[model samples]
Every structure is written in structure tokens, then in C-alpha cells.
Target: MARKKTDQKGDRLESIRDAHNAEKMARTTRMEDYLEVIYELIQHKGYATTVDISNYLNVSSPSVTKMLQRLSESGHVNYEKYRGITLTEAGVAVAKNMHDRHGVLAEFLMMIGVDEDTANRDAEGIEHHLHPETLKKLEEFVKLAKNQGLFR
Candidate 1:
């Protein structure tokens, strides 16, 4: 009975991990782009208004409104129409994770001699497709580079 419980627990953990990864993998580029923008808006401005997001993303106001509606409905964002938008807890976690990935990729590229502009652009494109393991390795590489005073 105890052995069976341990096995069941392990299986549950594995299932949860798989589900989390699937959610990450299932995100479309459009969703990621929106999340990234929302993350930035929240970080920089403390709150995200439709007008602010539209201007920051250079997207039309109508497009921003449509996406925000979808995001709010999907539980990624909290909306109150006139009040503004905030990310739900799960959405906050996802945004932070994606932003960290972008920062890590950008730093790695810069450490390896890519120009800042190119690194930023490339990181934005590459972070979405990179496997978690590859990102782990890149993160380690960045840490090692920093330890070696490569940034100085």
C-alpha cells in the first residue's frame, strides 16, 4: 500500500510537470507577444491601459482591445473595462518566465559578441523556440561568463 502510494505520487508529479510544459509549448507567438508587451507595460508603468499598450506595441487600439478581451477571458489577464488591466497570478508567472528567457538569451548573445541591437532582436525570436534544456545551458554559460568578468 505504501509502495503504491509512492508510485502514485510520482505519477502525479510527472503529470503536473507535463501539463505545465504543454501549456508553455502551446502558447502561440501571438499570445507570447501580447504577454511580453503586457509584462513590459506592468513593469514600466505599474498598470497597463489599452492606449498605452497600443502605443507601446504599435498595434491598433481595436486590436489591443480584442486581444485583451481574449486574454481576460482566458484567465491570463484581469480586466475592469475602464480601470485597466492586470495579470492574474498564473499570467504573472508566465510573463516573468518568458521575460527571464528573453533576458538570458539576450545576455548570452551579447557576451558572445553579438551587437546589442541584434542580440535583442535575435533573443526575441529565439527564446520562443528554445528547449528548456538549451536555455538551462545558456543560463549556465551566462553565469560562467559573468564570473570570468566578461561583462567588464
Candidate 2:
């Protein structure tokens, strides 16, 4: 039988590495999602409100407020209570990046015969985690496939 609790004591040495990376991805994902919604709202409607964002994202109003406050603190948006929300330049850059990523992934999936709605949904799910190199290759494949009339 496996030794159930070996007597070797836990290490007394220092921790191996920093703890920033895991949380970084989570935080970045949240930031990107919020920014993407805000960007779409602004693009189509000329304004973004907490209620609109909450509705688009399907999060509670309070949750949206809390996140907006955090984003305000981070220089991603100009948020004022009951006023309005606007993405700063930095925020616009990130949001536009996510939007482009979504477009590419969805188009690629559709090129592979996935339906449009499912391609878009799956793109939203996975767009945040793609590496730059992998995304570049997929983008290239989609571009060439379209141009060469291979997937059409």
C-alpha cells in the first residue's frame, strides 16, 4: 500500500516562483470581455451604460458597477456613477484586438464547415487563450483558404 502520509517534512526552502501568471490570465480575460462588450455597444449605439453592459454581458448591475470601478482605476475606462462609460485609448486597443480575434476564429471555424452561429459562439469561448503564433497561423490558413477557393 502507498504510504498514506510520509514523515518527510514540507520544504523549508523558498517558494519556487511568482504567483502572478494564473491570476493575470483570469484578470486579462475579464478585462477583455468587458472591453469587448463596451466596444460593441459604443460602435453600434454611440454610448455605453452600466445597464447596457450588464445586459450584454448578463452580469448583475452591481457586479458591473464593481468591475467598472476596477476598470476605471486601471485606466481602461472613464466611469462615473450614473453618468456614462467610455473606453480610453488603451481600452480601445485591447477591445479591438479581442474583436479581431473573435472575427478570425469564427471565420476560420466557418471555413472548416462549422455553422455561423456555432462558429461565433465557439470563437468567443476560445479566442482569449490563443497564442499569437498559433493565431497567426490560423489567420494565414483562413486567408489562403478563402483566396484559393478551397473552403468556399
Candidate 3:
């Protein structure tokens, strides 16, 4: 029937959309990790090189180079071979957001009596998956706890 065909077409489209979304999310996660590391390295040192990133992430230099090339093509980073990497404005914005999220999550864990080491480890695992609303709530909670002298 026509209705059956329509439904099948809709299902096929939905499946494709779901696949696309999943792939996009995976790429975003990887990009976020790289941006976070690059932000830290730049803050600590003067710049971030592929070798520095590979060493920091414990990944291969080739892998780092490949990702950097992808990031550069995507406009998140400006990469020149044999030179260092620098984030563009958009990349800096993403990195700053990620850094703030990490801090807020880590602070919340610490407020709840999680050990410093454990809090850092847990925050790293948990930060990327949190929704914006959840992060906002966590930030508010951290602020409230700090105001109430709950943090030592």
C-alpha cells in the first residue's frame, strides 16, 4: 500500500539521521578532547605542538597529526606543518566552555566529599556527557556551597 511505503521511507530516513547524529557526536567528543588538551598546553606553555599533544595524550604522533589536520580543515585550529597549533576564535570558545564545565564538575564532586584525585578523574569522565542545563545547575550548586562555607 502507499501508506506502508511511506512508513518504510520514513523509517529509512530516520535511520540515516540517527547514524549521522551518532557520528557527529563521536567527532564532537574527540574534538573536545583535543581542544581541551590544546587549551591546557597553551596555557602552561607558550604554544602547542603535535609532539606535545601526542605526549600529553599518550597517542601516536601520526594520530595527533591526522586529528590536527582534520581540526584545521574544520576551522577549529590553524595548523602549519613543522609549526605549532593555535586555536581559532571558535575553538577557543569551545575550549573555554569545556574547561569551565570540568571545573564546575570537579568542584561539585569535591564539595560532596570526593577525594581530590577521584574528583578529577570522575569529572574528566563525566564532563562531556552532561547537558547544558545540568552543568548550569551544577555551577549554581557549587556557587551556593561555596557561599555557605561548605567547601574547605
Candidate 4:
């Protein structure tokens, strides 16, 4: 029947959308983690090696290499065979955004009486899921709290 075929087509489209969403989420999370780590390492050490990233993330070297390759292909980083990793401008922008998001979340948690360690831990988990509008609101809240001496 025509109706049955239409329903099947709709189902297929829905399935495709769901799969695409899942893939995008996974990629976003991965890129966020890698960029953040690379940013920190480069800030501290002037370069980020695959071994350093592997150790920092507790992932294997090969895994880090694979992800770094993907990141390089995505124009996020410049990867060389044995030199080190460097964030491209796009990568730096992403890393900076992620870092700011983490800081705002952690500060908010601390302002609300969460311990430093717990605040950092919780912020890391919460930062990736927040929308831009939600993060903007949070930033405003933190500013207000700071003005009120709530963080002290």
C-alpha cells in the first residue's frame, strides 16, 4: 500500500536522523576533549605530544594517534609524524570556548558551596552538555555572584 510505503520511508528518515545526531554528539565530545587537552598541554609545555595526550587522557598511544589524525583532517590541529601537535586557529578557538565554559561551571559550583575538587570534577562532566544560551546565563549568574561577594 502507498500508506505503508510512506510510513516505512518516514521511519527510515527518522532512523537516519537519530544516527546522525548520535554521531555528531560523539564527535563533538571527542573534539572537545582533545582540544581542551591539547590547549592545556601546549600552554604548560609549549607543545603537545601524542604520548603526553595519551598519558593525560589515560588512552593508548594508537588511540590518541587516530584521534589526532582525525582532528588534523578536520582542520583543528597540525599534526606531524614525529614533531608534536599544535592547535590550528580553529582548534584554539574551540579550546578557548571549552576552557571558558569549564571555568564558569566550576566557579559557579564553588560559589554554591561545592568543594574545589568536586566542583572541578562535576564541571568537567557538565560542561560538554550545556547549550550556549545556558552557558551565557551561567556566566551572568557567576558575575552577579562575584559582585555580591558570594564566591568569598
Worst window of 10 by summed lDDT in candidate 1? 23-32
Which pairs of residues collide in model 3? none
Give stretches of model 4 more than 4 Å off. Answer: 1-27
Model 4 RMSD in angstroms = 6.6
Please give, for residues 1-152, the per-residue lDDT of candidate 2 as tens digits. 23433322222122212224554645578778999999999999999998998898999999999999999998999999998999999889889989999999999889888999999999998988887788999999988988999987
lDDT digits (tens) for residues 31-101 of candidate 1:
77888888888899788889988887789989988998888888899977788889999788778888999
The alpha-carbon lDDT assigned to residue 54 of candidate 4 equals 92
Best by lDDT: 4
- Note the residue pairs that clash in candidate 4: none
lDDT of 2 at 149: 91
Residue 19 displacement in candidate 3 (angstroms)? 12
Q: How high is the CA lDDT of each candidate model? A: 0.86, 0.87, 0.88, 0.90
Can you tell me which runs of candidate 2 are displaced by over 4 Å? Answer: 1-27
User: Candidate 4 — worst ten consecutive residues by lDDT sum?
Assistant: 19-28
lDDT string for model 4 (1-152, tens) is: 99999999999999889867875865578778989999999999998999999998899999999999999999999998797899999999999998999999999999889999999999998888776898999999889988997776
Deviation of model 3 at 105, angstroms: 0.5
- Work out the TM-score per prediction: 0.77, 0.83, 0.82, 0.83
> Per-prediction RMSD in angstroms?
8.3, 6.7, 6.5, 6.6
